[model samples]
Every structure is written in C-alpha cells, then in structure tokens.
Target: MSAPIPVKVHYHKQARELELIYENGERHRLSVEYLRVFSPSAEVRGHGPDSATLQVGKKHVGLANITPAGRYALKLHFDDGHDSGLYSWDYLWWLIEHREANWADYLDRLEAAGASREPLGIEIKQL
Candidate 1:
C-alpha cells in the first residue's frame, strides 16, 4: 500500500553511485551525476512546472555526504556545494522505476538546451 523503504543505502565513492537495496531483494544504483542533476531541491525543480533550472557541468559532481532527513527522506550533500533537497522514499522508488526513461529525458533536455554535462573549464574536443 505504501512505498517500500530501502533496506540498505550505500554510496560507492569510486563508482560515484548510490546503491539501494530493498527488502524484496530488488537493487538499484543511481549515478552521482544523475542524482545531482535531478535533485528535488527548488533550485533544481524550481517553484512550478516549466520553471526548473537546468543543471549543467555536473558530470564530475560527487556526493560529499548523505544524511537522513527525519525518518522519511534523505538530505544529499553534493560536493559542488548543493545541499538542498529532501529525497523521500516514494521519490527514491520512483527514480528506481524510471531511471532509464528519466536519463533519456534528461539527455534530451540537455541537448535541447545546448548544455554539456562536463564540469566547467573542461572540454573534450575532437578535431
């Protein structure tokens, strides 16, 4: 009836990913860049529809920390200095379910906006 809470939450620093394991033996991993780009914070989500601030140059973003926000959500601290956003259990599950589609959508948005995921000051140019 309710969203399932992850039984285990692990951040793989080397892999730059967050791993979630549910009680039902389901597992999911979200990249740091993906999490950073899709943060629930108003800075990322904006105040309403069509108002979200496009996050660019976050491919190298790392998780500085992940703290619990009471018992219902998580407060993610990104190394890039973004500390807002409360990722609730329902949202996490939703992300797990929609990872692929969400990623595709994000990429499409980036393309439309002429944004690059590479961190600022670093560009890969092929001649």
Candidate 2:
C-alpha cells in the first residue's frame, strides 16, 4: 500500500487546529500545541538519535505561517519565533495516527520533570 497524501490543509487560528484532508478521503485535526511541542526540527529533535529536546511552555503557541517545501513537506512558522521544522506528509500522518499515545507520553514526561505547559512570565526590575 502507498502512503497517504494530503489533498488540502487548513489552519484555524481561533481553534488552534490544523485540519488535513488526505487523498484517501481521511481527515485529521491536530492541535497547534501538539505540533509545536513535537516539531520535526533539529532544534527540537536534535542531530542524533535519542536527543529530542522537551518543548515546554508552549500551550498557547500559534501558527504564524505555513509555507510549502518542494511539494513534499511544509515549513511551519510559529508565533514564538520557531520556524525551522519541516513537517513532511508521512510525519504528519504519523502524528495523527499516534496523537493519543504521543500526548500521553508528553504529559507523563512533563509531570516527571515538573515542567509546565504555561508560559513563564518574566519580571523586569528597574534599578
């Protein structure tokens, strides 16, 4: 069997969801937070195996832009200044298929590390 190909892609800012329509007539919706935390960039996934960097404090991150990458993948630009991840079609499908398990793992890791999805507020002190 051949891999599934996307027929259309839509990003809803208010809902913070990415809707993907596949050629096989399957549709999938993925949240912005999930995509951001699981970005396929080296900055997040690292250069070698087992080097994924845990992305925290991105529960409200928004998609700034989505640019096509040579008809094989997409370059997602995030509102938090992240624009390196190239999400391929296969990767997107994998994310959709494993959304539940992946999210559970992320939550477990966050709890174990005492990390939070809420952004940290920085206070500036005036001298």
Candidate 3:
C-alpha cells in the first residue's frame, strides 16, 4: 500500500472513541475496546505458533493512554492494565481501514470457537 498519512485525529478522549481521517479521504471511527483486544503484544500473541492468549471480557475496555512510539507508531495502554504493544502507524491505519471486516471476522471466530465477547454475570444470594 501507499504511504498513509493521518489527516485528522478526532479523539473524544473521555468517550474513548477515535476517528482517523486519512489523506485519501477515507474516515474510520473505532472504539477503544476494539483496539485493545487486537493489540499486537506478546501477552496477547503468545509465543511462536502454538500459543496465544484468548483475550476475553474486553468489550468494556478503554484506552488509558496513547503514547507515540518514536515517529511512526503508537503505544496504547488499556484501562485493563495491558500496555506492551507498539502499534505502527501503518498498523493503526490498516485497522481503521478494515475495521468492519476485521471486527466481523473477529466475532465469527469467537462464535466458531464457542467464545463470546460478554462474560457471564454471576449472582450470589444469601440462603
């Protein structure tokens, strides 16, 4: 792909929503939760080809901070205490550009694996 330029970054910091406007006139609105679950970290990616942490219960997660990595990437810290991924500008751009398709695929994979985005709510009663 060609070089990607972020023409505009509209961040509703309090709401944890980021909208990136690309130089080519494409706009992408992404939720913080989506970004967190897809983080490119060893904690999430695991080792080599036989291990990967199945990230769950991140539907309510949000970005705690967004730090620049040198001049070409973003290091995102999630409110859930995960902060070990350096997201390249190109990676972020790709995520934004293919948000819908990727997210749909994510959901499909979750379903195929008998997993869910929502955790079970437990109720305790005094008996």
Candidate 4:
C-alpha cells in the first residue's frame, strides 16, 4: 500500500495549523506544536525509542516556514529553531492516522515527568 498524496497544503498562521488536502478528498489539520513534538528529526526521535527526547513547553510554538524536501517530503521550520525533521509522505500519513493516540500518549508522558506544555514566563496575549 502506498501513501496517500496530498494535493494541497496550507499553513494557517492564525490557527497555528497545517491543513492538508489529499487526492482522496480527505482533509486533515495538524497543530504546529503537535508536529514539533512528533518531528522525525534525530533531535526529537533520537537514535532509538529509549533515547527519544520529550519536547516540553511547546504549546505556543509556531511554524516559521515549510519547504518541500524533494518530491516526497516536507521540511518544516519551527519558530523555536528546529528545522531538521524531514516529514516524508508516508510518515505524514501515519501521523494523521494516529494523531489522537499519539497526542494522548504524549500528554501522559508529560504528566509522568512533571512537565508542562505551557511555555515558561509570561505569555502575553493580544486582545
């Protein structure tokens, strides 16, 4: 089975989400923080599962840029200075398929580590 191809990709800065429209007429939206924490980059994934780093205080992280990495992957640049992940088409499909479970597991891990998704210091809000 091959990965589903995305016909369109849009970044909604206000919403902080990446929207993907697939050839099969399916659409999915993923948050920037979610993508960051689940990045395929070695910095996030590490050498293996046991070495994987937990990305904390990323609730307010934003997507700085998105560039195509050849024809099969995307290079996502985060505002927090992370730009090493290469999100392949196959991997992206898997992420969309397992988003809920993965997010839940991440939250559990954060709780266990006594960490938080909230950024440190005052997060000023605009009215």
Give all TM-scores, in the order shown. Answer: 0.92, 0.90, 0.77, 0.94
| Candidate 1, 1-127: lDDT as tens digits | 6679988999998899999898999989999898988899999999997899989999878888899988889899988889999999989888888989999999999999899888778554322
Q: What are the runs in model 2 whose C-alpha is more than 4 Å off?
A: 122-127
Collision pairs in model 1: none
Worst 10 residues of 3 by lDDT: 118-127
lDDT of 1 at 84: 94
The model with the greatest lDDT is 4
Best by TM-score: 4
lDDT of 3 by residue, 26-72 (tens): 87778887887778888877875457666766776666677777877
lDDT of candidate model 3 versus the reference: 0.75
lDDT of 1: 0.89
TM-score of 1: 0.92
TM-score of 2: 0.90
Q: Put down candidate 4 lDDT per residue, 1-127, tens digits, no spaces.
A: 9698799999999999999998878999999999999999999999998999999999988888899999999999988889997999999989999999999999999999999999888865433
Q: After superposition, how far is residue 5 of candidate 2 from its true place, in Å?
A: 1.4
Local distance difference test, each candidate: 0.89, 0.88, 0.75, 0.93
- Give lDDT: candidate 1, residue 118: 80
Q: Any idea how many clashes model 3 has?
A: 0
User: RMSD per prediction, one decimal?
Assistant: 4.5, 4.2, 5.2, 2.4
